[model samples]
Target: MLFASRPTCIKRLLVIEDDPLTAFDNEHTLKHSGYDVVATVDSGEAAVAVIASEQIDALVLDLGLAGHMSGREVARIARDRGIAVLLVTGQCPVDAEEMAVACLGKPHSAAALVSALKAVETMTCKNKTPRKVSGLTTFWRPEAA
Candidate 1:
């Protein structure tokens, strides 16, 4: 139940970012691009809480956060719960093993962010869950040939 009118068309997204400004910018970009932002959390703990409470469709995660668990951990939790994740990280750690649909390097533009979100939406539309998104869901893994 993401969009009030067309839930099947546009899905809800959760943003896990510690920086208020970055989160706001991401929210603004996604909202303007016709996506429903369900929630924005500044920590992994809050992210876990919201994921349990809300019917979320996708997640936009930043690598580093203020809590004990980083965004990689958040992505892992989301993947285990069958939620789509779009990772935005300054550094793509080699050890990350969870799944993520989209990964944008830091200092990305609003347009790039929008495009990444659209990719997530398309994957969700096709597969209903990110885990089934044809190799795009595997975190830190190169695209499958």
Candidate 2:
């Protein structure tokens, strides 16, 4: 079945999780949900580097990363660059409201992940202006003077 208001652009997603199994699961879920899994990295440093260089549309980030920078730090940088982020952690962070679009607790279902992705897509689309109709003209008529 086709969606009535599907996003016009394909979303490129980056997964940043330290655990190998979790990373694999996240990648699998996103791929099946129709997002392009750009790269899955285990360290915050690597994730940050990829975010800087790649054309990523969103990020699925783990709170405790393998490297020096925590997921919160990485998310902050990604957000500054206008990339949408969803934080996944064993326990949700208190400051997630300021940094991420949403936070999912660890051991979440595939359905939950898909739902969060859709929310981010909708948020991104809202920032863009609707397409202008072609060959349309508006003439302003003066009231009788």
Candidate 3:
């Protein structure tokens, strides 16, 4: 089975999470999946700074960061900057309309993360078309963004 790979230029990602163990695990998984993680910040403030400085392709954000700024803030900034976001959090009840990023529930599988990342990449593509999976929706385009 030859699976399609995401765009090569957009391989960098940022991770914002308060838990070191989960962050490490996620980093390892993303790296194994061929993503170049730019940084791992424990707070949304730090994440904002890193995002401002680096050319991040995507963000794996945790809503409950240990700072005044939350992942929602980071996601908002990313959306404004046209950077994609993947929100990972427990059931804390976020306003879907407030978030322009993909939301993945806690304790999600690696396959789900990969799928979300791929969808985000596809959405960021130049075409901006949405792809429908077996029973899920994904924004995927073959054009460059």
TM-score (C-alpha) between model 2 and the true structure: 0.79
Question: Which sections of candidate 1 miss by over 4 Å?
Answer: 1-10, 95-97, 127-145
TM-score to native of every candidate shown: 0.77, 0.79, 0.79
Error of 1 at 32 (Å): 1.3
For model 3 the local lDDT of residue 114 reads 72
lDDT tens digits, residues 1-145, model 1?
Answer: 2323233444788988998999999998777667789898899999999999999888989988988987878898898898878888776566544457667778788766765665566555654334333223233333344
The candidates, ranked best first by TM-score, are: 3, 2, 1
For candidate 1, list the clashing residue pairs, or say none. Answer: none
Q: Residue-wise lDDT of candidate 2 within 20-75, one digit each (tens)?
A: 99899889877776788999998889998998889998898888889788888999
Clashing pairs in 2: none
- The C-alpha local distance difference test score for the whole of candidate 3 amounts to 0.74
